[model samples]
Target: MNPSLRNALTRLAFMLVAAAAALPAAANIDIQHWVAPNGARVYFVESRVLPILDVQVDFDAGAARDPAGKSGVASMTQSLLDTGAGGLDEDTLAERFTDLGAQLGGVADNDRAGLSLRTLSSARERDGSLALLRTLLTQPEFPAAVLDREKARAISGLREADTKPDAIGSKRFARALYGDHPYGRTPTIESVTAISRDDLVAHYRTHYVASRAVVSIVGDVTREQAEAIAVQLTGDLPQGEPLAPIPAVTLPQASTENIAHPANQSHIFVGQPALQRGDLDFFPLQVGNYILGGGGFVSRLTKEVREKRGYAYSVYSYFNPQRQLGAFQIGLQTERSQAAAALKVVDETLAAFMAKGPTEDELRAAKRNLVDGFSLRLDSNRKLLDSLAVIGFYGLPLDWLKKFPERAEAVTAAQVKDAFQRRLSADNIVRVIVAGD
Candidate 1:
């Protein structure tokens, strides 16, 4: 063979290998399910690859359920749920978990509150950890001392966050977009101080019903063991009234507010309340967003704001669909001097996309990338458990994950254009730029 031809063939072989390496491993997820006899929703995935059990219990008691004046109640309530429960005090609970070689964690977000346990699948470790969880869920003592300390900590954190420009922008943006809705409120120091032990108990009783809970278990656990675990965890909770349906989010009219913040860079966010979890437009909107801004370097916003003009270090956008309509936001940070220029480019890019949706090539690439990357989203038991929790919480179809790629592939250019046309209007977007001219 000629030397040049041989070198070219070697390069082609290397390229093919690289391309194959880049593709994600095929997804072979097998999700199983059964309702606990106590009425708790149970989602399980049995993976014997590792002798670890990752269990998570999610409740609908999130920040959105905070009372009008007590914007932080849900947050504080969740934080204290495991702090003191059953006959055990906070210190004893911590010591017991440590002795069992188990890890316990809790998360409180806008849409949900969750308690998670990670332990060895051995009987002693698993049973000990699960017993603690059962107490935390059904027998929280809500000790007065723990409540006072956590309240003080929460208040102090809120005070510190108040001084941050990004925090101010986020709170104001949520307020502006959600208006009088519960989603708009941010917890204040005053509200945190007002939260009493009784408040936590009441919130838990009302929202932590078995029917409203989803128990997700993944790892080396049998079907019988999973059912037994779910029953033990949720068996004693009072079967309260069904969760009050979350009302629709009415996106308030667009309005610009200039919050005075003494910061060197301006944080600008433009968007409105958008879709919910099960909305028909989710797939199209999600795929279109990757083309518009969610694709990092390949996104239109990054190309316009950073690559082309160098107005900001980073510019990005995403759609967050929660139980209620969450926001579809474009965010960027730039020096006060370049804020106006950056904002203009973001607006122009969004306007153009709204008028003429993603091109066929752009749509195809977005779908291809998203579909190919889907498996990675469920590669681990923790990831699978998280996805299952979301599915069970939102009443999404059991086949949502299996069907995700197909749906992305089926999203036509016309559907992407139509979904955006009906769901978002450029004229109705709220633009908030702090420290900008």
Candidate 2:
């Protein structure tokens, strides 16, 4: 969630709304699919239970697509989409949505850029808000002044992040793990401030084209309406070429980067680029990650580092599968003096798990938690929209949701051990320690 939205939602968390429950078998919910005349792929799920609608438009334009010397173009383009569009300025756009009781936002990340709208299903509200959404999509102004303002804001944020040890360690970890891979590049103050309106226009024209779009709708609408919505969103898009696939990520050789900082606690990170989204090894790694470090109190790393030695308050690890090989990162912050001990314990815990695999009890518990909690993933329109966007964007199996729990259940201890052993070599791990002696 965006920080602004998070704060807004935090306040709304106390408000009581009519409670609704998803189907008992949320995983088995149907997803309708089609392609628009303009070459945009569309996915939809009709949930007439609520008189509401959620529509999202996604393109294969993310940070990884940023051109050399223009590291923040993708993000800036997404942000500026809502700044002004059609004939409306940011304030006018805000007023339009507010009048209609609609929520609007844009999301940009490593593999996708998206704009989303949530509105009441009545024709008066839905039709108008969606029309405004189309204008934002097809006619973003990228006003010169807004571009300058956003660039300055981004640079200011980056400058603050630069001073934080955790942020320093994370950025260094990416560079070390990816070397020259596109996944490694992030906006620096120099790069972000260097961006201009021309750069935003060029990137938007190239990357936000029709051929590269996925229009996802989850709401109380009919098939005819969904098709119309999809076309309205992408038909006017520039027919620029779809992005060429990102280059494959190569594993980094074992290395360590230790940076000195004036912080009381050291921030440490470990691991390397591990798996992409549709890999066969995903199941084993997902289940195995739980027992190894993703399960909180039950995880081996937490048990060894916090429960036994009290080196850190919390420790965790997980795989971030992306368009290319994302990372399998383990991260923790500890008192600078105890950083060494915490890191040693983390390594030992990982090594032991890789050698022996998770215990049967741990495997059962992990599977149970993942399976039992699967329904929550589809419990809301927003959550369903997320899944649809990912599926449409990544070209995953249409029945991926149905197969998710089955795959997790099928993963045994031996399979997990083998997957981890083959996919990760402790020898090739890259380590980053900030402010630790």
Measured against the true structure, the TM-scores of the candidates, in listed sequence, are 0.91, 0.95
| Tens-digit per-residue lDDT, 105-183, candidate 2 | 7779888997999987889889999999999999999999888888888888999999999888888999999987888
Residues 1-437 of candidate 1: C-alpha lDDT, one tens digit per residue:
45753564466457445544343233455677777776788888787766668899988889988877887888888888777888888899998887776778876888889798988788887899999989998888888988888888888888899998888899889988888787888888888888887888888889888877789888889999998888888888877787667677886787778877889999998999888989999999999999999999999999999999999888889999998998999999999888888888998998888888999999989999999988878766567777888887788887788789999999998998888888888656898888776
- Per-candidate clash tally: 0, 0
Global lDDT of each candidate: 0.84, 0.87
Error of 2 at 321 (Å): 0.6
When summed lDDT is taken over every stretch of 10 residues in candidate 2, the lowest stretch is 10-19
Q: Model 2 segments beyond 4 Å from truth?
A: 1-19, 22-24
Best by TM-score: 2
Superposed model 1: Cα runs more than 4 Å off:
1-27
